[model samples]
Target chain A: MELRQFCSQSRVVIVAGKGGVGKTTVTAALALAATRAGLSALICEVEGKSGLAAAFGSDALEYDELHLDDRLTARTLAPDDAMVDYLESHGMKRFSHRLAKSGALDVVATAVPGMKDILVLGKIKSLEQLPAADLIVVDAPAAGHAITFLLAAQGLLDAIRVGPIRKQATEVVEMLTDATRCQVMLVTLPEETPVNELIETAFAVEDRAGVALGPVVVNGCMAPLRDQPDSITSLMAAGFSLTTSTQAIEAVAFRSSRHAMQEIQIARLAEQLPLPQIHLPQLLTAAIGRAELNKLADAMAHQIELLQ
Target chain B: MTAFANLATTREIIVCCGTGGVGKTTTAAVLAIEAARRGRRAVVVTIDPAKRLADALGLDALSDEPKLIDQQTWNIFDRDPARSGLAQGTLSALMLDTKSTFDKLVHEHAPDEPAADRILDNRFYRNISGALGGTQEYMAMEKLHELHTSGEFDLIVIDTPPSRHALDFLDAPERLMRLLDNRMFRLLMMPTKTYLKLAGAALQALLRTVSRVVGREVVDDAIAFFQAFEGMEQGFRDRAAKVQELIDDPATAFVLVTTPRRDAVDEATYFAQRLESNGLQVAGLIVNRIHPEFGSESPESLRALAHGNAAILNLADFREIAIRERETLETLTARIPSDAVGYVPLLDEDVHNIATLATVATHLF
Candidate 1:
């Protein structure tokens, strides 16, 4: 499977996971990968996370898109701004501004359950319809809220009998369930809790939200140490200066066990989720910069190539 | 004693807050266990936890009420060398059941049984009680207040939701109060007939737009729900004020937890700043899963020793990670006192059982 083919398969790829699982990073990496594959990519985050913009060596993102590369762009979308945009695009321009000024958007957002999610999803739906970019990747909210976030459309359809809101939700649901239009890619660490939550979230999105899922991105995996001595004891028995220190032996022991634990979780994830896994190596850096982002993007491209 | 240990033992309330996947829940559990080891009756209220962590705390199917960790589980904690000679104390764990907590609050604040039942059975209430943006945070605070007033635990440790909205709870009570006080909310509280008759043109236009947007039916349901609680606003208001006061109480301390990752560190600093703006300060900082400094060997010396062996090269990678982590730790802890910062080394495995949690506590203390 070529990375370009994967990018073309879905107009929108929603990256979701538990917090700190690198969903934003993966979202950026996927966009970068798609752009490198010669596709125009737009990455959007809902939570106004500076990390997303910072990934591309930019400042904080506002509602307007910030051009990151020749084929890449990024922006943050808030529900209120999306709502205003939705209204103005729908020909209620003056009314929308007035509503925003009066702080009625907050009221309207809170007036109905799931209205906030619908507003954002509705904006994304319009974006998808436009074909302004070959790919649109959304950095969704964390897992717990993400279930409710993705399912808001269906939930709203059930709650509201008729109105523009219901119509908007119905459209959002259409975009979500259509496999070619949108697919959610959940990110997770190769750990127990996140893996469990990812499995649960994957099913809930598919079953309840009626959304399609793409390959799971397993972030922070430790690559296997190659050309190794058989064991820590054996390595220490070699009696090098570094090996003589107990901390070195301990470090090796720690890495081995951590690797073993990660392998176990990865196996468990494979057994349960049934999604192709794209393993991203753990970078030993204080922060993810442009260099690390390219490294992760290349890793993703390599994995996508390996996928059948 | 370390300031963290002292804070864990002495604080009446410790709220552990951080971004997700930073081990906020586990850190909360560990602090609770430590408090219990020091002979304080500590209870940890967690919003959601991993299955293994729930099982480890003997709360697999925990209800809204606090469930005490059995003596047998304490025996596991007692086995740790760090626990030797420590006075054994009681530990209880509670999982936050948001909807039920809201139900209890409605029952408590409602004017009468019929009113309570009316609000509880509202279609809108059923949806928003659990799914409202900050309902879980508000309910967590409500539950904490309930537990505090109960006098059942000497210390209460609460694990907040992920950082993006972790501080939402701080404003949740006020937000709730403002929501109740909003003019639209009051207008909606009116009977439909009265609302239409009295609403100004601006108000009418807004409602019309709202109806066109959300559907007339949801507005009706929302109105009915608010009408059901017409007389109970005072009660809810008073309760919200009390919760706010309790949160602002000097005895309630906040703990900022994070990993050494850039984003998590940024979130921690942001959380700390938010707390400071609220006239509160982080009592302690716990940095989890840090790669420890391996050895004194320099990369050049290690390379000479490695002589192209991949495993030896891997050891060099570990040293780089350790150094990067130490630098990151310094950047983070530079904002706070050294004694107030607890950096736990990367454990050999994920903490699934009590034994592993005990291991984390050893590093934390």
Candidate 2:
């Protein structure tokens, strides 16, 4: 139950939530934080987006394990590429090359619903066992697909029953369900829809995959607007014509209420889920570059330290 | 600044495509609401099985069948579209039932009830229908094509799923066709009975050794699923072609939705190019949730009014955010073709109801 120890000890950490809630950014920050704490870490992405490249202020990240910083690395794990790698590592390099050449990798890997996920996770599983990094942080798909993803191994186990696929799925499921080795870290915004999806995803993560749900990182949360002398709404109700200046101030008032609502939602979310929560502030920076990322990384490190 | 009005009005189908968490679904729903308010009967088909769209539309749930918005539901949105003398049209919405849609497609091409049951009963089909890659998007297209041909409404708005596969939605039909048409796949699935009959004992043993990774039973089930399509491949291929043609129609519009973050903006640009490369019509882009800068109020005056108190401090924080967001958005908008971009400012509240969606529609339409 020790927060920092749990974070440090977990071998595979999954970050997921509703899309656009900054899950990728959070993943990068968590990896950066782990590296800061002097732990070898690898952040993984499978969505084929330029999120990490943009975060690192680069052009693109390759499927090859590319270094992000000292003790930190990232890779966009493509299923096709993963299958080829999986085969090659198993001494099927020629067969892998043929599969890639024939355009059959896509067809073969996508044969089942979770076929793609299995390959991606299988590769991650190998990486987890490797000494390349002590922790493997995955920027999984959004809430719905994430559940399907975590359960993919289980699904294959049920369907295939006896084969290499079943054996691979068994390893994946074992690693995923082991609380000491794996954890699901959900990232969400303090909003109705994302919070609702978070609740749904959290339960499914536990009930479906039997994995322990780790800390809930709340992103883009607003700080409280300080108390004022006179209320803007009351002033508006006292019958003054709304000028541009008045309107601007009133808008601020509305935003303050929204911030308060978010605070309440965060509380409600904590009550609803009853898990450890980490809060990330809404940034004032125009763009998140290396500097912003470093700041978030430090804050995350501090949060993990506080988990004790 | 773009011609969203026309795209919202004139197109037979409007696909709001975006990455997850970008308010794409809200935009689609608002577009449908706006079209109806503009006097065009419109229906929005969403892929969020979580019922978020239904909640946004003020309905408890949305099934595959289009449900017309009742008068009571319409009143929840503060504005009166009929009284505005603009739209006065009807609006209905539906949520995709992916499995049922796939089932329907199978049943249609099965050639008979027993044949349909054979494919439908296959373990692979039963387990994989909804979870199959690109199945949701394919079904969304299927529904779009169905609605377009049904003539039930003048407009169909597609809320594309947040597919991590991004461009796969556009080429789903082609991918499916390619897999089905693969000669290797045909050879692999060469029905167990035929395979055993044709292959010599030695050849059969080699085949079994090669296929054991996925299980012999899985191979059998896969062969059953594929062979069940013996006479139906052509029909499915033709249907896939027709779906492509429908998307290629000049009247179709693909609206790329995104946020103004550097990552989101870059992804949007990439998606816009992908749609064009696929030969689909790119109507425009909606950069949603842009923070609007407050106009012309000298910050000095506001600070002087507040006498260095908390109100100005809070307002100043938001003002700074507004200015920063505006800069970031301008940088992104410049990369996009000017005529292909529209803007929606950040709303203080999440777009969770018909009323809120109406507010969004104002900026959109």
Error of 2 at B185 (Å): 2.1
Query: In DockQ terms, which candidate is top?
Result: 1
lDDT string, candidate 1, A1-308, tens digits: 98899889999999999888889889988999999999999988888865866767788898998899889998777988888888887767768987887655655566577888998999899889997699999999878778989988887887888878788998999899999999999999999878988999999989888899999999999876666466656766777643444555566677778888999999999999899999999886778988999999999999999998
Model 1 / residue B164 / CA error / Å: 1.5
Q: Write the per-residue lDDT of candidate 2 for residues B1-365, one digit (tens) a residue.
A: 22776776788888888888788889888778767866789999998766788888778889888999875565344454543556578889999998888899998888899999998998767655766677778888888888888898999998877754656768889877776776555765675677667655744443354365566776567667777867888888888988998888988888888887766776777777788788765677887887656554545565556545565555556666677666667766666564667788778788888778777766765
Worst lDDT run of 10 residues, candidate 1 chain A, spans A240-249
- Residue by residue across A129-238, what tens digits does model 2's lDDT show? 88458788999977788888899988887777676777888999888988887899999999988898899899999997898988899988776656653655644454
Q: Which parts of model 1 have CA positions greater than 4 angstroms off? A: A230-251, B49-55, B79-82, B85-88, B188-198, B300-308
In order, how many clashes per candidate?
0, 4
Please list the residue runs of candidate 2 whose C-alpha ends up more than 4 Å from where it truly belongs after superposition. Answer: A1-6, A225-255, B1-5, B75-88, B164-166, B188-210, B295-320, B338-341
